[model samples]
Structure formats: structure tokens, C-alpha cells
Target: MSQMNQPDLIGIADVAAKIPAFLNKIPNLLHGLKQAYLRTPNTPTGLGMAFEKAVLRNPDGNALLFEEQRYSYAHLNAWANQIAHFYLSLGAQKGDVVAVMIENRPELIATVIGLAKIGVTIALLNTSQVGKVLAHSINLVKPFAVIAGEECRVALDEIRHELAIAAGHFHWFADQDTQTDAGQAPEGFVNLAEKIDLFPKFNPSTTGSVQGKDGLFYIYTSGTTGLPKAVIFSNGRWTLAYGTYGHVLNLNQEDVMYCTLPLYHATGMVVCWCGVIAGSSALAIRRKFSTSSFWKDVKKFDASAIGYVGELCRYLMDAPPSEQEHGHRVTKMIGNGMRPNIWDKFKARFGIKEVLELYASSEGNVGFSNVFNFDNTVGFSPTPYAIIEFDKERNEPVRDTKGHCKRVKKGETGLLIGKITRRSPFDGYTDPEKNKSVIMTDVFTKGDAYFNTGDLVRDIGFRHAQFVDRLGDTFRWKGENVSTTEVENMLTEYDKIVEAVVYGVEIPNTNGRAGMAAITLQPGSELNEQDLKQMVSTFKQCLPAYAIPVFLRIQQQVETTGTFKYQKNQLKEQAFDPQKTDERLLVLLPNATEYCELTQEIFNNIQAYQYRF
Candidate 1:
């Protein structure tokens, strides 16, 4: 980390220069803040209300653009209305959860909004999930029915028997525009599109009856300990995001935002989409991110803004220069994980004027938005928060004699916690036990409680903080949280592996840690070439692509503590260094299908950023 490579410090004067622009937003910001807090448990306002307002304001405007397909606000709204009416006819009621697994497309958006209008909580299943992971998520909520697109039918069918919902309740929508092209529905699944074709295309009367306290979404997160846990994202909490980050982006009707991130994530589904509705702006989306197709899409859509995460930016930075990269209408970018190292570099390279880098979790109470356009910080949080001293070895926050968590000095790194109150409430995971683990009580007072973010951040001046790293068993890679326990469970499940320990290790010039696993073979098992490749295939099937380990080490036996916890800290320090350990190391380099021997030269190349993993 050389001084020349470091990002420029944001000074008081630099912040002062942005006051005029920020002041201009005070009117909308204040209104948004008011809307956020005032929408109480019983208030008849939520995502559906916000979206309907957008439609009223700009019915004919381009509301969505997916590749070559275009959808006006009126057209999209009608589709959602039809969905809501048809679901209501099926006896779908408020508080009844419905699991929907659709890839990034208009169908997904319409389904979410339609369900919300009728007060049906939608459980947005991650498109990447398959087998046990997918079944676990769907079963956890015990949804009334499961609605999946054609793209996800196979995965859903594989887990149908394991799901709590009955077989006949499954509904399927074709991947294409089902209204125009009604693809054949597979056996045992209802054709949702064809059934809803004649449904009235008007706002559901139930929209006005939907209360804020009612559940809106069940977003699943891979917990630090086990399989994914469903988080209760109530309509009341939805207002917090819609009113805050929504207004912060300040897009207009004419501005088009291009988003390539997965819609299942909060950043894409909530933050980015909220902003579009707030300003009646158009949002362009891709089925999946392809660096090769990014700039062309931006140019094609004439996007005024783009959505991103740190890893997406790194890919663009790593790509070779092209003519299409220059002279695009992408003046503003919004998202999170824009690290300090490439903060300015990305902006300059892409010619972006504003980067609304934000900090938030799917279920966390607090959030940080770069409203002031800070260069390297996650920006200031308006809600009550603390960056307290954390003891790494003990894995807890440091407490004083009076038993209050001590806050770190300004500009020092510490654990981030958000105070739970009426305004900033922790919706928490569906599992009450899991909720208990993250809620820290008696912090600075006997009755106070704070939601532990399980992340470390540096408290820069003026209430701003820079994200440092994730703590405990969870690590972020490729903008997705990789659960070490989950990965370890998958690895050890293999018959040839006796035991497995997983952790995250830093790679030079990467936004987050790359997954690494250390394992011991079975008594009779040998680390043969066939078995090594088989391990790769096993992981690909069991785990999401991002959760697959990029590095592996064959250990005599996994070291553990007296309490039987794996000594992951020691292995993390040793990492993939061939010189530090006598054991064999294997790597799944970028774009390589199989793991290969990590020779000294190969390790050097990785260190020098020759491999982009």
C-alpha cells in the first residue's frame, strides 16, 4: 500500500464544496425522511403504494428495459395488476408467504409488485440456489405456494418433494413474455401466465388495506453457522429504504439506470429499484452480468446511471480498453463495495461523475449512503450507530468495568453496531435463536440493544465510516457472503474427505477474500488426480459458484481448539503460501475448469495479479 496508490483524503473543505448540491436535495430528502419514519406499523403505505404513484406520474414512460425488450410503466403496471387479481382469485391472502424463483426479468418484478399489492409476502429465492440449499430456503418459510419461472422449473422440481407446499400449488410462468407467447407449462405446474391473461388490469383494492407491519419479503441470508436463514423484511422496514436511498440517488424521469446485478439481492431489488420509482426513471437490466456485454448495453440504453458492486468494477478495470468504454451517458453510478484502492481509479476510468456507494445488509437496522458523494467512505449514517472496540481472539466487543461496549477512537477500526429503536428497528431473521445471536443487549446501558453487523469499519470524521472486513465465519466474495460453515459442511459431506475447515483468504488487488479450504483425507483415501477433479465437480453441484473454494490444501488433520472449533485463524495466516507450508496446494485459477498443482511460479503469478481470481 504505497502513498501514490492510496485514495485522496476527503477533507472538511472538500465536503464543504458539496453543500450547495446537498442543500438542493433538502426538500426531497426531508420529505423522504418523514415518509420513512412516519409510515408506522398500521400505515397503508409500502412498496406497492410507491410504485403505483410512479405509474400515475409517468404511465407512458419507459419503466423497464431488458435487453431488446421495452416495457412502459403503464404496460408493466397492468401486468402486475393482472397478477395481483389472479392471485387474489386463488385465495392468496395477506401474510401468506409465496416463494418465487425467477431470473432477472420483467416477470420477477411484476410478480413482486403484484404480490405486494395484494399483501402477499414474496420470498425471493436466489436464482443460483439448487438442491438442498434451494429446498432449505423454500421449506423454511412454509410458503402457501411456490411460483417459479421456466428458467427455474428444473431446480424447483428437484426439491418439490422436500417442500412444505403441496404439489398442485406450484405455479410456473414462461421465461418469455407469457402474455404474448404462452409457453407450454410442465406437468404438475399451473400456467400462471395463461390463467391471468383475462384478469382485470386494475390496481387491486387490497392495496389500500395492506399495512406496514405486514411481511413484504422473506430474503434469505447464509448465516455464519448454517444454511440460509430467512429474514423478515416487513413493509414497515421497506419504507426506510424507499424513502432514504430512494431520494438520495435523485434520478429523474429522463435518466435511465443500467443494472446487471442479481435482483434477488437487496441492493438491486430494493435500493436500485426504489430509486427508479422515486423519480419515475427507467431501469435497464440484464439476465446476468457479462463484462463483455456491459458497455454495449449502457450505450444501447443510453443509460444515465449504472448500478455496481466492487467486484463488478474490478472486472471492468481489469478488462482491456475498448472504444465502446468511452463516450457513454453513464454519469452516475450507485451501489456498494467500491473499495478505497480503486475508488478514484474506477470513476476516472469510466468517467463517472457520482458514485453513490452505500452500506447496508439485507436485515440490518442501519445503513450508510454516499449522499455527499464521498470518495472512499461508505458515507454518513443518519441513524444511531457505534463503531466499538472488538476483541478478535475472544470474538466479542470489548467492555469496560461498567460492562458497556467501548467505542473506538475516531479514525480507528471497530465492530459496527446499530442501535435498535422505533426509527431504526431490527426486523431480524425468522429463526428467533439466530436473532438472539446478533442482538447485543446492555450496550452502554442496561436496557439498550444494538444489532451487531458482524463487520468492522473505520470511523472516519463527520460520522462517516470506511468498511474494513467481515468477522466471524462469514466472508464476502464476489459481492456474495460466503459462509465458511456451510462450505465446510459441503466439503466434509464428500465420502473421501474425513474433515474439512473453510475460511476466507485475501488475494492481492481483490475486493474481498477468496474461499479456501483445508481438509484431511479418509484413512484409505488418496489425493489422486481423479479425486481432485471430482472434488471440483462435487462443489459445483452442492455450492453456489461463488462459494466454491478457489484454493485447497491437504492437511494431515484439521487443527481444532479444546471446544472443538476449527483453528481457522492459524490456517488463514498460513493461507496458500507454498513456502510457508509443506503440504500440497491446489488452485482453481480464473476460467480454469479444474484444480491444478500450485507451483512456486504459479503462486508468484497469482501474487503479481497475473490471475484475476
Candidate 2:
């Protein structure tokens, strides 16, 4: 028998063990299908409607768990209604945008729900953003009102003059117990919490008129490429996400989802919260993610599921093993960016039964989920998508003579494009030009459009894909394309390395950028000569010559976005320049077995086009 046809006993045993889990997915799949079919297109399917439905089903059920406080579904709904009424009284109307800058708290959730109820689109501003970025994000949306928590008062105050909104429209709410009445309304801001008492705790009639196609959220991109772009998150897309996770994941009222991700991110706000609402379950939220507090919080809340980004999982693995890490109530985790290197290890260590590793972006129409508890794959996407051939040099899709993009064969890495259809429409960014730049016209035929995902993925068969790297992140070295994600994954497998952010750096007199990695060592670990040699040896054995990073920058920590995505733009720009950064630099010169220190002399030599990479 051919090796491909031969089934090993270990593989058979693993399959047998997963039989029950696979069988359980049937009912959930059917439920998802029913929900998808029943959703009324172009009609009102706002999150407010779903929240109301969830409240009706489980009025007394715990809806939100934040720090020491817990609010029931009815309680939360009433608070949302009160806020909705207050906003309505402020003359907030349908189709109006409201910029919201709040930390991850119950108030944030309540404010979002409240705004949705009043038919006001929310520009969910990142709490971490400040000065120019903050002002730019708010100005891009042009919101009529700006609502902020006391925690973000300083940031809002800093950019208040830059914003076009009136001073009276500025609102603030107190989240801290120490906050006084005088402190609540910082200078030009109104105290939103105080005004909530004047409004009735009843559902607003305006919510009924809100349609599925209406703007729901203006979620800003991670700003990995450049400035953050405001991406539209429509009610239809939100509802679809709700159905997929709630029904397909088989969440129930008994489940308590622990969400430590930022509330501004789509994963936390839409995916995590929508699932809780869809299943009428409880949500345990935190102000921010902390590795030390993660497991403890999970155990404290008796959480049955947790949300994660790849960095969170990595942070957990890097932390010292604790008694609290094991024997937790958590059985499932739902999120994206879980690397294959840490996948099995994270699951085994944490005692998690399922990891619903998903693949989706804020604005992209294509989405995938591992519904069958599959390992190392962003499982089946029902949406119409194509893995098309791309030109690495031009950084665009490869077009045929007919001017249509061609699809890649199975197991090939290619750019992912989602078909822009009526059912799965691409509700693009706030900037129309930015939207146009990503959409490929006549992709398959004349007049057809597809939303470019800006991600390169490997078709792993069965409609599944393994994320390779971002289109911009992949760089050419020695005339061979190198995947930054793939290189970083390999580097993290080394014992001494804790984290790695791989990028390409321009080399003097070189045809293309050379591979470079900024790595953080494990606590108390040092990159000695022996360690350096071992790293080189390991890379030689595991990766192709062209794929290996030519330079290594050792850092104390890796900078990440609020959502835990690695900040590579800065790293790429400041590559190996000793004058630009204080971090230690090491370089593997052509055919060198070990990495040598990149001193000022060597740096100058490389920059002056004296050395060839």
C-alpha cells in the first residue's frame, strides 16, 4: 500500500477518541444553518433585538460579571434602556455616529448596547490610542457625540480641541468608586451617569426601525500597516457572527465566557459578547489582559470558556506553572491567531477540551472556524472565497490575460479574497478610496468584485486553511518568499526564546529585503555564544536557507497592539540600526554558522554597501 493510503494505529486511536466530540457538532451545525436561513435580510436584526430576546429568555440570569460586581440580564437591559433614552434625549438620531472610548467594563458593554438601541452607530475608539492617532480615529468617523469613561478622560481631553464635535456633546461616565460628582464631568464633558437617572428604563421604539444593513460599529484596524482605518461592522455581519458562535459552538445559559481582550476589538465586542447574548449566557470581563490574573480570574468566575489572541496564549505558556492554571472550569476557548507551535501544548497544559481557532478580520467578509475541534487549521468557511495567485514583488494579485485573478491549487499559499455578493456583502472601511484599493474588480468575470483579505493562507484541504502570513508581512530573500509567521513560529520553538517578531529589512546593494527577527528571551535567559550556535543549527535543520532570518535583534520585550498583535511596522523601519535603537543586534553573515555582534563598524559597513547579505 502507498504511504498516503496507510493509516497508522496512533492516528486511528486519535480519531476514535474524537468520535464523540465530532458527533456533538451535528446538532450545533443544524442550529447554525436554521439561524442563518431565518435571519431576515435588510430588516432590523440589530444586536439590541438579540439582547432583548436574550433578556426575555433569561431575565434573571447573570448577564455580566466585572470585577466584584454581577448584573443580571434584566438589570443590564434596564441600564441599556436608560442610557438609550438619555442619548435619545440628547437628540441622537438614526444613522448618527457616536464615538465611544471606554475600557473593558460593564459600562462599556452597557453603552454599546444602549447606543445600538437608540439606532446610533458606535465608533468604538481604542482606549490605548492618544494624541494624533486618537484624534485621527475620531475625526475619521465624524461622530456627533463623544462618550468616554473617567479612565479615558485625559486622552479625550488631550484631543478635544482637534475633534469637530460640540463641547456640549462630550460625555463622560464614572467607573471608579473614588470618582466624585465634580470629577465625573471633566471640564467640557457632561456626566452621562447622572443623566441616565432622568430617563425611563424601557426599550426604545427607534430600535425597531434599524435595519440589518445599517451601520452598527466603526471598528478601527490594528494600524499594523499605517494609520488605523475605520472599518464598518454592520448589523447583518454581527448577527451572522452571533449565529455562528452561539449556535455552532453550542453555548448555553450555564456557560460563563471570560473575555479579557479589549472591548474595542471585534473579537471581544462582537464575537465574544454576541455569543453570550445569542446563548443567553453570562460574560466575565476584565479591564485588560494580565497573564498573572488570567487563570485566577477564570477560576474565580467559574468560567466555562475563555477568549484569546495568540499573544495571550503565548504569555500564559511563558508564565510559571501554577496550581490555578490546572483544574479550572474552562473547557473551551474561542479566538484567532493561535500558532500551531503552541496549539497542542496550550490545550494540554490548560486542560482545555476545545480550541475554536478562528480566522477573520474586522472588515473582511471571509471567516473560518474550527467547528469540529480540528487541530492546526482555520476550519471550514461556508462563505464564497478564493485563494488566488499573488505577485510578491508588486504586492498584488496576479491577473490572467482576461484580467481575472486565478485560484491556487490545494496546499498552496495564496492571497484570500471573499466574493462580494448580496448575502455576504463587503461593508468596507470609512474611507471610500481605501475600500476601493482593497476590492479587486472583475476578479472572476467582468463586473464581479471580491474583497481582498490582505492575508496569505495555505489551503489545507477540506475548505480549511492554515494562516501563512499577512501579505505585507511576507518578504523576499535570496529570490525566495519568506513567511514571517512561519519563521516566528519556528523561532519560538527554541527553549530560550519567549517571543519573536519577524520582518524584512533592506540590505545595502541587495535585490530584496533580508529576513530579520526581533526576539525576546525567556526570563533570566541570555543568548550566549553556545545559545547562538544552537539557534543557527536548529534553523538550518528546520528551515530552508533562504527562509532563515539573516539578522536577530534581542529585546527586553515585544511591543504589541491593544489586542496583542505584534507591532511590526516600527520594527521593520528600525531594523538592526544600532543608532536607532538601544537593543543588542546580531547578524548571520553570508554562509556563517553562528551569529556575530552587529557593532557600529559592521552597521556602518552594511549601510555603506560594503557587505553583501
Candidate 3:
């Protein structure tokens, strides 16, 4: 074959190798398509229905595995029914919102399922939230009642006086086996576990009235930008998850999924749980993710599949190699934010057969999944979406003369927008103004509207795209855009660098913010000249001239959100100012081969924009 035809032949061979896997996914894909396109309007389709069907199909099947306890479908359904009946007795009805503040436990899952059954919207509060932040989340939803787990009792009590909930509206449930009666119920709170037995163990009548579009969950964002916004998670969206991840991933009765991710996040609450319920499978639940115990727990439960976020995988990979890592039953892994650089290493190290990296957000309407077991891509999205050119400074889509957003070329990164339609409506946040801020109207036509995802992605052809970075995370340096995620991913490839958080810092007279990175070195490692030389060499070889970070702040540790996402707002606020932080600061001047301490003179030069790249 000619040289030009040689590459074509290789590409054909790659596709041929994947033909079997693609064909295996056809049945599930067809089922998902049917659910997405042929769903009945006003039908009772949601998590409640999905759970009910699973129970009916196999009430004796294992539903949840938490610590030493194994809950069968029948037992869990009975518990959920009793909770629903108890809520109804309290005069709670459809459309009422109930605040649920709990960690990952059987009670938390049961409470959400029970509330859905009774047509009451569940506000899944972040367990890490406390004081003013917790109060804001609870008040924003205006829940009729607040249910606190024994673990969160102290947090709830700290702000009980400030809550707007009525008297007798506070409820608490026991989560710890060792919790004393006194500790179980705080002041001015009723014990839900003690009262749940008083109600009947039968499905409530309200389940009949719950429709597809009804409110199911009010999941809060990470609040990295500000106070967490309560995003609306409708029953229809839950139904879609049931079909997509459940059927498309081909989960079955024998498959057990280990989920250590927090239940407040959409990936855990909706995606992982819905798939488990739809398949009539058991879920192995952990109170929190532990790198040391992760593989042991997977082995203990004999989990065939596992759910994760990028950071979870990173934590596992960072830990010393364990004997249990390769011998586990986890053949399929699902979730989002698996970085391209670590994807292959993670799969190879853990013996994962399928890596289903996905792309989604709590408030965004668009979602992509690696259904075909593809590497380094978020996978093919069947949903209607457009990748439009975006302006970094303005933080909006670049529009043409006719005021329509222009689509980027196949290989370019751009803003991702989901077309809003009857089938794929943007549920948006509870706050109307917040929804208005993200929804763009008349984008391509006079009547068109789209949900702005506020994420930059590269179109990688064949309807697949790779997540580049968040809109605000990408910064301009030397008049060229630099993706923080891309740079951070590269930085972590070096063995000594455990974590890297990249952001932009404004220079005194620069056109845009220069790149800065706050990195955490591996234990027993030092930021010496040799290490600096290696990092500089890697950056030069792997990144563009403008994309390399100009400043480096050596943090002993990196702060992350409850979901394991790096918190950059505080670091950005502190920047490289010597007074703001005590961490060692280093700088790579223009045309410099090594990093040196950021002295007063160098700092002043950077501030005054005296040095140009």
C-alpha cells in the first residue's frame, strides 16, 4: 500500500477490532433510544417506578449491601413505604419539599426513594455543608421539613435557630449502630427511625399521581463559585438515567456495583443508583471513599462494576500497589472526569475491562457516555448538541453577523450547548434568575433556545468529544488560550507531582491573566533544582510555549470539595502573593530553563509586566 493508504489501513484495523464491542452494545443502545424518543407524556416514569418494578420482579433479590448489613428488595421497599406513609401522616403532600441532610447510608437512599414515592421533592443537602452554607441551602429550597441523620445532628443543631422550618418539622434518623438514644435525637427533633414503625408498610397512593415531569430531587452544586445552587432533577431525567446507564451499560441481576461516591452528587444519586435499580442488582455502599480500603471493599462485596470520579481513580492510583487491586471482580467502571493521561494506566493497573468515562453536570442538559468502551473520549452523544466558538474574555459564545452562535471546526475546542426541546428540556436551577443566566434564547433562529453548558470541549469526530476544561478554568496567556485541565493532566504525569491545580493570575499591565499552578508533591519529594529541570523539560515537550504555567506555588496539600473536585477559588484569590500564603513560590521567567524562587524583584517585574513571554 502507498504511504497515504497505510494510515487508512491502520484506522480500518482499529475499527475492526472494536466491531464486536460495538455490536454487543447495540441492544442496549436501541433500548435507550426507545426510552429517550418514545416515552409517554404524563406517564408515571421515575425512580419510584423503577424501584417498584425491580421489587416486583424480584422482591427476594439483594438490593443494598452496607457494611455488615444486606438489605433485600422487599425489606428496602417496606422501609421506604413506611417512611412515605409517615410523611403522609404529617400532612406532607405532592409538591412539598423535604430537606434531607445525610451521609452515604441506607437511610439516605431510603429517604430519597420514600420521598419520591410520596411525590415530595427531596432536597439532597451536601453532608459537608455546615453553618451558613448549610442554612442557605436549606432555606433556598424552602423545605417543609428537615430530616437529619444522627451523623449530621450537630450540624443541624448549630443552625436550628436560624432555620425557617416550623416547630415539629425537624426529624432525625439513626445512622450509627453505636449511637445512644440521647444522641440519636437532638433538641427539638423527632426520631424518624422510632416513628417509621408506626406507619403501614405498603405503597402510598401518592405514587399513582407522580408523573414524569414531577420534581424528584433538588441536588445542590459544589458551590465553588458561590453559595450552592439547587438544581432541579425531574422524574423524567431520572427515568432517562434508568434507561441509559442501566440498560446501556448492560447491568444485570448478578452484577453488583460498588459506589463510594457521595450520594448528593448526580453521578452517585441518579446515575449509579438508577442503573442498579433498573437492573435489579445490588449496590455496595460505602460511607466515604478510602484509598486504603477501596480494593478490599470491592473484593469483599465481589463487585462486578464500580463507579468513580476522576479524583477517586487518582487517589487509588497514587496509593501503594495493593494485592487486592488486580484480583477484584470489577470488569466495568462507570462515571465522569477520567483524565486522558491516567485513563490507560488506571485501566491497566486495576484490570478494568471497560472504562465508561462520561461527561455531565448537575444543571447541564447534555450528557455523554463512553458506551462503546472508547479511550480518552467522553464517547458518542446521541443527543442534539452544538460546539460553538467561545470568547474567553467575554465568557460567551462568539456570534456571527446574524447573532447566531458559530460552530467550531471538528478538532477545535468550543463552548458546549444543548438544544432545548420537549424531549430534552433543561430542568435548570430552582432560582429563576439562575436559570435565566444559563439559558440562551434565539441562538440560531428567532425561536431557538439552548442550555449553555459553560464547558469547553474538543470535537473529536464521529459525534465523540473530549472535555477540555471548564469555561472559567481556561485562561489566556500571551493572547493564546490555555486549558488548565490539559496542563494539570500533563503536570501529574510526572512521578513526583501528585496533584496540580492551575489557574490564572492577573498581571499589572498584561492583556490577560498569566498561568499559575498550585501543586502538591508526592510524599518524601522535594522541589529541588533537579525536579524543576524535569518538570520544565516535560512542559516544553508536552505543552505549547504559552500554555506552560508561569508561576508555581508548592502546597503541602491541595484542598478539594466533598466530591473530590479541586477547589481553585481560594487559591486564585491568594495567587502567588508572598503575604497571602506561606507556601514556597517559584517562577519560570521567559526563556528560562529552570524555576527559581520568586524574589521581591521578580515579583515586582511580573506585577509591572516588565518581562514579556
Candidate 4:
């Protein structure tokens, strides 16, 4: 958007429109903020306190809704309490890390809260992780114990020898709800379901002592070095999200929030789930996101709110329109990664009243929320943050001679950096050296530091901004920035393409890398002559000449991380090399109107600069 148009996106009236609700919520919001910032060991708001509040509010009311099960606040709380007492009996102590690996279910939520209530830092291992990655994540934290679902038993067994914990430390919960029928436990594994059955159903006394600074969960994120890094998410930070986003949702106990996203991710567990707990409402969960069963489950639960990521919205939009989709009670959505292109379309199609698209990182301090119900914005940060000029090619900030980074003007793009303070603390990676690499000291002044977000954002007016791209995924090309999102967006618009992952690939002797895309096509679609021509034509018509992907790799599916984020590093490493990958490669040559199969001869010529991109 232009400078003249930027002001129209959000203004004084927009903020004023939300003031009435804001005024009504002043006391609660203030209390939440106080709990978030104050470093109190007792009475510090955390997961245990928050859930207890909901349980006390209405114990008989629905707290969780899963397949064929409606666990009341009282029931879930009691179950969690029993689990807590059982672990406590086993000498579990506060501040001890307990690694948990479970798929999305009520069991997962209850298990985490149970341990968290006792002040144990839950190391949330991604369920999709297997073998080496799974073993590595567990050993990274060196947890005191392991609690896993029967579904994950094979994976745990595969890497059992690699783990540091003794065989007796492993506890198993049946894949099905183990409450009614304590299912058989795997050999040598303690049956948590059967063992905890005899424990008392009362809140642990240690709940009050979980300080604000205490680690709540350790979430693993992809690292620059190709391994996963454990990021600390403190009770303080989680409370900040709880108080901030929970109020933004403005849900009541009557509401139901449906979340199908992975629980291991912060977006679902901390953000969406907290919103439910904050409202003292029911949280309806699914094993996984399913387009076919989404509306069916929504109607079944009468869900008033839903959770989403960018791709989830797109998938829903693409699914055949059904009577079940529209006229539902789902009036709100809360999650990040909803692109500007689909923001309005998603709302209009689903009759959604609010799209609370937010931006936050488990590793970073600053967070942005869509407070004013603005469109296509990541909203504003209550904490201090700056968008500064950066060098994309050099992959660093462009600092002035005075040793201060320059802030981008409104309607300009720049790297986002959040100033670190007690209020906005960057509880970065567990690796101290890794943390040092991201913290920029002396950024704007002699005695200041800022956390690099590794993101490119375009500033709109009124403290709001639009997400541009991940700094690493975007590359400088032909003296211009080529974001993968830009190319990916254009490519996915084609009818044949189901998903597109774009990245920059180096050509021999080139000043900047050229654009390449790995695309997964629709079912029954093939890379035939006519389709290739139309795809190239669409690229020529819709995208910039330089932005057009010079190379294409046809893939059956795109690999994604546990959080549904594209695993681009692997794709970027492989590039479009025919020799490196057995997958078919195609290229659009100089002045070509259609894409053709890339052979060894064509690949060598391109490397030799026989054809210019």
C-alpha cells in the first residue's frame, strides 16, 4: 500500500471503536498485565492458576470436548489433579523438566496442565518427530521423566537406547482415553492411567509457588545449523499472551473454541487454548486438522471460535462449499500467518466477525495482537519494537556510521527488532552462544540491546504492520528483494498447483540467486505440454519478470515442520539439481514461453552462463 493509502488502514477512530470493550475489561487486563510482569513466586498467574480460575468459575461446565467425550471442568481438573498427585508421590519436584510426547487430544492438554500445576517445566516434544530428531529433542533438555502415548511407543522404542533416562522412567497412556478403561501398558512401561487412578483429585499445593520467571514449556524450533533448538517459554510470557489475547477474544463461558492445529506449537497450546481458559469456555480439540470433518465437528461442538494458520484458511477456502460451512456459530479465529491476499476472502466466505491475526515467537519477547480488529495487519506491539533498515544480501542490519540502526519510514519494509527489557524479556534459545548471536548490543544507543526477529515487515500506519517474509527465505535478486511468499502466492493461484514452496537458488557466476519453486500439483495433474505453457503464461502475466521462477522441481508433497511451517532449508540445499534428486526438474529458458524438462546439457549450459535468467 502507498503512503497516502496507509493511513486509511487504521486510524484514531479504529482504536476508539474498541475502547468501550477495552474499558469494560480494564480491571481484568490490568490484573493480567500485573501477573505477567511482576516476578512473584506466590500469586503469579501461570497455567495452573489460570486453569484453576476456570475450574473454580464453573466446575460443572464443559471444559474440554473431544471425540465422543465431554469432560467437565471438574472432571478434567480432577484427572489432572490425580496425575499431579501421582507424580508428586513419585518425588517429582518443582523446576524439574518432564518431557512429554503426545498427539493432539484431551490427554495431551490434561497431561501438560497436570505437570505444569506442580511447577514442572514440560518439554513439549513434537509428535511428528521420530528416531534421531526425537531422541535429540528429549536429550537436549535432559528431562526427569518421559510420558508418551501408545501411538508414540514405536518411535520411543526405536530411540530408547539413545535416551539418557532409565526404562522405569517411561510412562504410557493408552491411545484411547485411559480413564474409563485402563488399557494395557507396553512391557517395561508404567501405565500412568492405571497408576494415577488411585490418587486423590485435588489441586497440588505447589501451584502457588510456580513463579512468573519459571519455565512453563520448552518448545523446539528449527535452528540455523539444521538441528532443533529448545526455546524457553516462561510462565510470565504465557500469562502475557493469556491476558492480552484472551481479552482481545472477549469470549464468554458460553463460547466454544475449536482448535485442530498441533498442540506442540505455541499458536494452538498457549495462544488459542489460553483464550479458551481465559473465557472459562470449552475447548474442542481434534487429533489433526481435517478439511472433510472440520465443519462436521464444528457443528457438532457448536464452536463459536476456531484456530487457524495461513494454510488452514487456504485449505478451507479451496474445499467445496458446503451448507455446513456457512451460518455456523464460528464468528472468530485466532492464530498467525493469515496472508493479506486471503484475509478478507476468508472472513467473507465464512461469515467471520473477527480475524485476530497475531505475531509472536517462542524465542522472542515482543508480540503483536490485532486489538482493533484491523484487516491484513499483525496489529501492534504493546512492548517496544522497531523496524530498521537491513541488508538482505549481506543478511545483516544496515547500521549508520554513528552505530545506530535506522528505522524505516511508514509504508517501507525493514527488519523487525524488539528492544529487550524486563517487561519484554527475550528468553531465547537454551544455547547461550546461540542466544548471543541473535541479541544485538549497542543497536540504537551505547547501552541498549535488541532481539533480531529475522523477519521483514512493511510498516502500515497507526503502529500496525504487514508481514513481508522470513529474512532467510527472501533473497536479493536483480537489485530487488524477492520474497518467497511473493512468488509462492502467484504460483499457487494457478488451478493445477496445490502448494508452492519458493526459494532463491544460486546460478554459477551470478551476482544474486534466481528464483526456484518446488510445487505439488493437484491430484491427477501432470506436467504436460499444455499445462506447462499455461503455468508459464500465468507467471508471465501475474508476476514480475524477475520474480518469475526460472527453475521448477515437481514434488508429490512439500515437507513441513511440526508447526506446519515449510522446511525450506532442505529444499534450498538441494536446489533444482537433477543429479542430486531423482525428482523431475523443469526450466524456462531465456525468451521462452513454456517450461521444458531440464536435461544435463541444459543444466550445464545454464551453469556456464549460456542462458541468462
Question: Against the true structure, what is every candidate's RMSD?
Answer: 2.2, 11.6, 11.5, 10.8
Single out the weakest 10-residue window by summed lDDT for candidate 1: 1-10
What tens-digit string does per-residue lDDT give for candidate 1 at 1-613?
A: 4322334445587779989878977888887889998877889988898889999999999999986789999999999999999989989999999999999998898899999999999999999898888998998898999999999999888879888787778999998977679798989999988888989998989998888888999988877766888888988878888899988888889999899999988889888988899989998999999999899999999999888999999999889999999999888888999878888888888899888999999889989999998788888899999999998888889999999999887667899999999878898888888889899999999999999999999887678889888888888899898788889888876788888888899999998999999988988667887876888888888899999999999888766557344367778899999999999899999887788999999999989998888
* Model 3 lDDT per residue over 309-370, tens place: 76687678767897989777898888887767788898889888898878877777788887
Q: For candidate 1, give the lDDT of residue 232.
A: 88
Candidate 3 residue runs with Cα over 4 Å from true position: 1-17, 177-184, 222-225, 473-613
Cα lDDT of all candidates, in order? 0.88, 0.81, 0.80, 0.83
- RMSD of candidate 3 to the truth, in angstroms, is 11.5
In terms of TM-score, which candidate is strongest?
A: 1
Candidates ranked, most accurate by lDDT first:
1, 4, 2, 3
Candidate 2 per-residue lDDT over residues 210-291, each given as its tens digit: 7788888998763433356788898878888887866666778999999998888888888888778878999999998888
- lDDT, candidate 4, 334-364, per-residue tens: 9887767778888998999788999888798
Instruction: State the lDDT at 547 in candidate 2.
Output: 65
Q: In model 4, which runs have C-alpha deviations exceeding 4 angstroms? A: 7-9, 17-31, 38-43, 473-613
Worst 10 residues of 4 by lDDT: 473-482
What does the lDDT read for residue 227 in candidate 3? 54
Cα lDDT for residue 56, candidate 1: 94
C-alpha lDDT of candidate 4 relative to the true structure: 0.83
Q: Summing lDDT over every window of 10 consecutive residues in candidate 3, give the lowest-scoring window.
A: 2-11
Which candidate's lDDT is highest? 1
